[model samples]
Target: MISSCFVTAIQVLILFTLSSPCVRASTFTGSMFEVQISTKLPVKDWVKEAKKDSDPFSLWDPTCFKFVSAIKSVDNQLKEALYTCHSVPGGDENTRLKIYLFIPPERLAPEKQEPCLRAAYKKAFDDWKAGVSANFQIRPEQVQFSCELSV
Candidate 1:
């Protein structure tokens, strides 16, 4: 017994409530280094647990330590590296992973740090494979790195 106008109004309200999170505008301040990983492993969950979680420092284990250590060793003055990761959608593999490394300005510049960053990621990959089971292994070529300025 509801009128069409009432049904339309309710639908609009429901749509707005569901889409509000995506409608908000936010800015990222810092440099963003992307680590693109293509693998069959459950990288999405691993990244969510290791980097995207609120208390990653507490959740991280030796693999995280080795990864961060390798990144820090890229430069003596390098101090900050914040991470956020997500799985790329509609990929051919089990998952295509993107790890965002955010660092403040006047610290690490993308152009100057890319090569070292690649090496660091390679080392991290090796450490990760060594620590995990055979099923979780990823090859060196499966990981790629790129850097960009945060807008």
Candidate 2:
């Protein structure tokens, strides 16, 4: 009973509603970054200085603490996102290493961080949001630093 012109007009209105500014999408990007630097001291002084979730001087010579020479853009100035694990098989594993979570500032304080996070680093995706719920599957080798969806 509806004419073709009326149907076309209704379709146009529906299309406009879906394409309005109120429905704009969020813009953000995330990536898993690994900071790798070697210690030259015979006893690994740099590692001793580096603290978990604590960013320490990249190179140390006793007086002035410095950031990494090559690091340019880091959102986490305090570098408080690093976690250290000694479960690796090496006996001296605890002596010479550090780990850090590099989350971009644009991706920080999101209503939903994970939904906006890189698919590869889903462990941080769900938790970044305030009340979001989801599951995460972390590999056993990376369990110490990852989130498990079930628990």
Candidate 3:
């Protein structure tokens, strides 16, 4: 009887262990910087730049196109979009953007977190670089970006 009880206990423990959620370290990308769009420029111009012939609007996700559409509806002198992408080991952030693509944290494997985050930062940097380049005519390479990670 005791042996049977012990086996049941061990089985229960194994099941519990398997069912438990595993939490891992999370890192935030693009947390240290913000993309500022000049209000002086027309929103249509920005859309046009983003939707250049080489990069058609259709190439972007439908949600991204929606984001750009939403931007068109808003009227502000200076628009700022905070680009913060976090990689949570077992979870995801559902937020999306037209300019900066937010990569969910769950898509990245444990070993590939850093590289994936670096890629995300590069995307954010490139988006900002392109925006300023179109608006202010500044060199894309000259734009600066600083990324930060938080537990």
Candidate 4:
């Protein structure tokens, strides 16, 4: 009888804790970084190709095109990069393209923070270069990439 009562009390306490409004879930701020892709081609040329058809993400791989398009529509800078692409030089003849990406804090798990972020960043970068190479029919190695992280 004592053991039963103890279990019942514990259950009630658990229920009360679970239902408490004062206890809030933890929130995390994800990491944000910019990727710069420098191309010999003009930025205007890239934008023109992107705007050609009903699907503006034609320059991106079909697999990630929709994802990229959704990211593009998230803010006023929607026209930037589909995934936050911006002409860093802000000129017609400039060859610099900057892309912003966020890595959810959950992805930073596995104990090693910096390396995890770098790996994730690299993967996203590889995809971008692949898309760029495909759009221009050039080799992936020819794509110039650099990472920019704001302090």
User: Model 1, which residues run further than 4 Å from truth?
Assistant: 1-28, 42-80, 105-107, 110-135, 148-151
Among all windows of ten consecutive residues in candidate 3, which has the lowest summed lDDT?
Answer: 1-10
> What's model 1's lDDT at 1?
7
Query: Against the true structure, candidate 4 has what lDDT?
Result: 0.41
Cα error, residue 139 of model 1, in Å, equals 1.9
TM-scores vs. true structure, each candidate: 0.37, 0.19, 0.27, 0.40
lDDT by residue (tens digit), candidate 3, 43-130: 3555555565353442333333433444334443113443322211212222212222233333222344466554664454455456
Candidate 1 vs. true structure, TM-score? 0.37
- Report residue 69 deviation for candidate 4 (angstroms): 7.0
Candidates ranked, most accurate by TM-score first: 4, 1, 3, 2
Candidate 4 lDDT by residue in tens digits, 97-144: 444333433343334346655465456556656766666555677665
lDDT of 1 by residue, 1-151 (tens): 0010011101111112222456543344444444444655553465556665454431443233334444444433333544534345644653443433334443343344566664664465444333322334556456555543232
TM-score of 4: 0.40
Task: List, residue by residue over 97-141, the lDDT tens digit for candidate 2.
Answer: 222233443343234345434342343322221111111122222
Ranking by lDDT: 4, 1, 3, 2
Worst 10 residues of 4 by lDDT: 1-10
